[model samples]
Target: MSCLEIMPKLGLTMTEGMLAKWHKSEGEKIEKGEILFEVETDKLTNEIEAKESGVVRKILVEEGETVKCLAPVAVIAGENEDISGLLKEAGVNGQEVAETKTEEKKSDNTAVEAGPKKVVVIGGGPGGYIAAIRAAQLGNKVTLIEKEELGGTCLNVGCIPTKTLLHSAELFSEIKDSRNLGIDVGEVSINWKNVQRRRKRVIKKLVSGVKGLLSYNKVNVINGFARMETENSLTVSKEGGKSEKIDFDSAIISTGSVPFAPLIPGIGLEGVIDSTGALELESLPETIVIIGGGVIGIEFASLFSSLGKKVTILEMLPFILPPIDRQISSMIADKLSKQGVSINTGCRVTSIEKGENGLKVDFTKGNDNLNVEAEKVLVAIGRRSNTEGLELEKIGVKTEKGRVCVDDYMRTNAGSIYAIGDCTGKIMLAHVASEQGVVAAENISGKNVKMDYKTVPSCVYTKPEIASTGLTEEQVKEKGIDYKVGIFPMGANGKAMISKEPDGIIKIIADKKTEEILGVHIMAPRATDLIGEAALALRLEATVDEVVTTIHAHPTINEAFKEAALAVQKRALNSVN
Candidate 1:
């Protein structure tokens, strides 16, 4: 029998590895432990050596092709051994194929079998896709059912597409502001059609990538709407009147959430839309009124304002980003206002009416009723969990306030069933959902794993990105935990000064008794990347003293993190005392 060399899993988090380069080709003699291919994982890149002393009769995967772990990458056989049949069976060739057929056999066997545990995951959004991939990795048969697109709201209509447009908007704003650095250029203009086209292209690429990943992991992708049939089964209905009954030992409901539209007269007027509809960008309106001053609203406000549209934000709360530190939020609000964005806080949209030329919005500020006019109205209140279609009661899954309830292990009341992501009603972040998905999978695989929300980070992709991990100052004060605050402004950083884009701050909270870092918050350019150190610091229980002692690279933004720790003890190097 020929020996099949499969791509070995390098790490727990690594699902697929790229064949960076092929050292040996097909029909070549290879010795045992000889380097055959170099693979690149998320953490690192390494070479895979041959296990058997024989001729490399087939190379299943080629350079640049990212194959899943444990999937066949090559086959070795003796010189006289007949390997043509094996090669043909495995679809081996010199050129790399986008996807391999090995996973299909595995998925078919697992899905059709009754002995192995089966899992039907609803919705192919960020949460759903992650859960399906994790379930498949844990040796369970997974059928991921999606109604519209694989990535659901986040990838299809929400986060991914919106971010792409925001990137364009940001670029446009930057080009216009290039004169600040004495770099004068021609007049900057934006072709809205081209911007929309680029956004669509990005969305298409990401959606295809997600589909490929699911296929590589042996996760069966079903394009349909899924509703609960019973506690242990779900019925997926396709578009062409065809339906399949999926029997599952357990089910992970990751249907995610959708934008919640408020009830008001003329709210559904021609020019009025929700966040998802606004992302279409059919045409940029001259003026826009964005209701709700939350993350979604502010994000849209930033994008539209940057695009040279007159944008007004109506916020019912006293401040935007109410969950964040008031001091930090006020700074961001001031920055937005300086950019010509109007923010009206402590105001609620009572009603909207369509005028002859534009839309009229009637809002109330306490006892005063105010009227505003805009070309388009956008409702950005919040999202509601997608728990409507799936009859949870029939399946014995308990839900509260339109959200599925799961324990620390991500398991629902229905013993074998699990719930994750937005449906679980925990932290609604994509990374948090992905982590929960893995925890659910591990639990199903007989491994004792639990979801850790304490270390989960939150990020807002605004002008100066905001990222935070761990407890907030309010929580610390409320709990009466003796904590020391350390803060460092970006203006003092050498890199920030050189870039001429320094308008942010980094704050660290540490336990006064133990000196252990309890939380870290940052607002700066590429603050998302800088938060990793803080996250690791909190995860490893690194104390403020340790962080301060660690030598950071000079003239870098990361030095701010180290300096902030030094500021905790009133020993900052750059701070003017």
Candidate 2:
């Protein structure tokens, strides 16, 4: 048998590499460790050396084609060897010898002959796709099933598209206040159609990109709805009645979650909609009554209010963003109120009645029963896990409150099964789910891996974005942990002043005993990006003193973090008091 050679990957993260140029073509003689081809990864371009010295008999992939790592790029055989039969057996052209080398090096000690393990992952959301890719990387034959879009809620309707819309709204609000910065532009107007078009375009690109990634990772994507047949098998029904039963050695349930709309009278009314429907609305309503004051409700309120729509937000809770810091949420509420958004907390929707002009929504606020009329009513109460029909019971996997229960390694009760993302119900954030995906993959590959949620950051893409990581003040106080807080107003930041966009603050909480940072919170422009440093600080267990001593770039919003750290020691540089 002739030795076969293939392209090798240089890094762990590289999925595919571009064959920049082939130094040796078919029918060319080559020596061991000689330069055969140059490949380009995202990080760098390098040359692939021939592993075995022989005649280059065949080239599997063309020069310009970007082939996946470990795929056979060329073939080598001994002089005058019978290469035609080898090429045909390896699925190459008859005139060329094919490379039949495996990607992984086989160990000689193992005597057990085992079939390839199959892994089937339900749902193509962030968690499912990530799990699929990771499972494929671990030498498992993987299959991914999705009913609609590849990205599920986060990409199709929830996070990506909504953020795009929120960005547009934020820009519109910023342009409205451009006069304060001596940039005198005329009255600003919004094109809702164009805004929605941009959002749709972003979603389309992200969905396509996700598909490409899955394909590159050699994960078989089945566009269908999957139902559990047994603990180790599932049946997927395609769009045109095509169905297939797939048996797997291991399975991952990552069906994700959906918006939870309360069952109320007139919920099926023409104007009433949920978060998904709200995202699909082609035109903005002249007036809107948003039910619930949670993250989703407030986000839509902020966006629509900035778009010059009359928005009324009613929350069943006593306050909006109840989980966030009370002071920061209150400030945001005040700012939003000043922007003509009506926020009514401690209220519950009782009923809705259709009227001649619009829909009349009757709600109760405290002791007073109030009625409000609007063109549309949006219910943004919350989301529930998509765990129905998953047949977790058969698999011995447990679930609580519509969330799959998993250990730190993201493994379900069944040893071979795992769960991640919203389905696991640990951290609902998308990035957290992606991290869990990696951890699950590593654990499955016999590596000791556990998910770390300590420094997971959360972001709300409102006009002034709110990004936070680690513990909140209320959480620290509830735990009876001795913590000190340092807060710096954005008004003191030179960058905020120059941009005339000082409307938020940064708060840092540190453990008093150890002086290590416990949490970091910020509400300002680009707070999403600025929170990363704080997250790193918490992850590294950096002390408040360390942050204070570190020099931040001058005239930047990031200075607020350093100043907040200084305030922890009662030595702030820009304190007005």
Candidate 3:
């Protein structure tokens, strides 16, 4: 049986639409959800997707022709099947053929003749695997090489694993305060074994899913360490010491970064560990001293403090989370301090020594010297690109301070070579790496795409989660822009009061002259999820008035965002303005 492809009524007042283009010709195969034709109405143009998978048996409407709503535009059925009755129902007199359109949808990438090109990607992290799958989609024979797990550090030991632990810690914290909500539960305690088990389970499931996607995309995944041997070829050394060589038309390097441990006296002591080691610890420590107060440091502090562990953080900078908005960071610092987490800024670690109880860390704050002893000492300063074994210099891929140098197109100095992710030393966030991967794959397939960083949102998963996008107040001031700020404390939000989490705020900064939203910062429940809306506002260059005019649902946290936008004009409705 055949189904009639009707001209859909796209808008409330739309009765007829012009068939601008037909993506599939008669007798051509089309999958469900694939674009079948383009429809242009008086209001807007839309790509109409196929409702069912089959061959286009007959087309009743030609390109640039107008058809009314519910009119049959085409007939879809099995290949070589009879569709004469359906065509007649469409009022197409006995086997009349419609002229096919030659126009096709344009891609963001530079259009080149589609052909089978062999593409090799080194590393299977977020960037490398994404590039491999995308390249394969663009008619390329893609081969991905990974020495370890398929999902790279993020899935194996970094983002997924750490967030899993944080979720468990957060749940424990919530349960401890459940009595305030009229829920009296038994005494709450941390299940270290269960937490670690869940973390491993989530990582395994995600890694397996990545492997399945690669197989589905027809990408050849090689389990081995890859090294560049020539400009066009590389050698892979497998676990059994067998080496195989591969040649490619294009190559992408996304071998990510590793934890960096600072050099200090007795730094190699027994209790000192990096972020990876900290995640895999057998048992939770009674007291832990974490060096560095960056994102990783602060997150770990939140986790430990919530779990009733004595935690201390030492930072060489005057403030923690130096990259984000200082106001948001300061609020998190204050919250952690109230939770009994010691945060010592402007402290320089001098040495680490083993004491009778555990390990002793000596540091200096200004002219004062101090020491803190804990069962475990974690070095969470930062990470550095892992380019040691790639032999990038052999291929003349330029490197500056141990990071691959790439242009806006994610192309390296060497021809046919590209780099992304932590190796490129760009944003270093997982999402940034994934976007760069797509950009590189598109450029390789002859699409002209450039990496844009203007709207990248940063998130920290501490309690009352922090997230921000665009410029901070300090950045705006440095640029000498006249700006206005709108801040709505979560205390004034009904949802916050109902949830007993009213200690955070949402702040939006806008240009004073035009009221264009310049930046958005949030330190509230689910701030990471909320920042996406702000990021889109910045991306579209939307003004505060637009946000204020948009009717937000009542008694929700999102209403607080709208309230903040209103506050920009000194017209907040829910609070005193």
lDDT of 3 by residue, 1-577 (tens): 4688888988778877767679999879998889999997644789999888899988877665555677788889998778777867777521222211112114432333334678899999999999998888666899999999989888898889999999999999999999888899998889899899999999989999999999999999999999998889999999879999999988999999999878899889888999899999999999999999999999999999999999999999999999989998999999999999999999999999998779999999999999999999999999998898999899899999889999888988776899999998889899999989988886776555688899999999999899999999999999999999999999999988897789889999999999999999999888999998899999878999999988988778888999999999999988888
lDDT of 2 by residue, 242-343 (tens): 989999877777888888868789888999999888888989999999998878898999989988999999898888987677777888898889989999
Number of colliding residue pairs in model 2: 0
Q: TM-score of each candidate?
A: 0.81, 0.80, 0.85
- Candidate 1: residue pairs that collide: none
1-577, model 1: which lDDT tens digit per residue? 4788887888877877767668888778889989988887545889889898898887776554456677778889998898777767565432223334234325422211122478888888887898888667546788888888888788888888888888899889888989987889999998999998988899899999999999998898888888887878888889989999898878888888988888877887888899888988678998999998888888898899888999899998899987676667887899899889889999978889976669999999899999889999999998888888788888778899999998887888887678888887787777887888877765665444567677777777788878888888887999999999888998888888777768988889889989899989888877878888988888778999899889999878889999899988888889753
Total colliding residue pairs, candidate 3:
5
TM-score, candidate number 3: 0.85
Best-fitting candidate, measured by lDDT?
Answer: 3
Candidate numbers, best TM-score first, in rank order: 3, 1, 2
Say which candidate scores most in TM-score: 3
Clashing residue pairs, candidate 3? Answer: 109-447, 109-448, 110-446, 110-447, 110-448
- Candidate 2 residue runs with Cα over 4 Å from true position: 1-116
Which residue runs does candidate 1 get wrong by more than 4 Å?
1-116
RMSD of each: 8.7, 8.5, 6.7
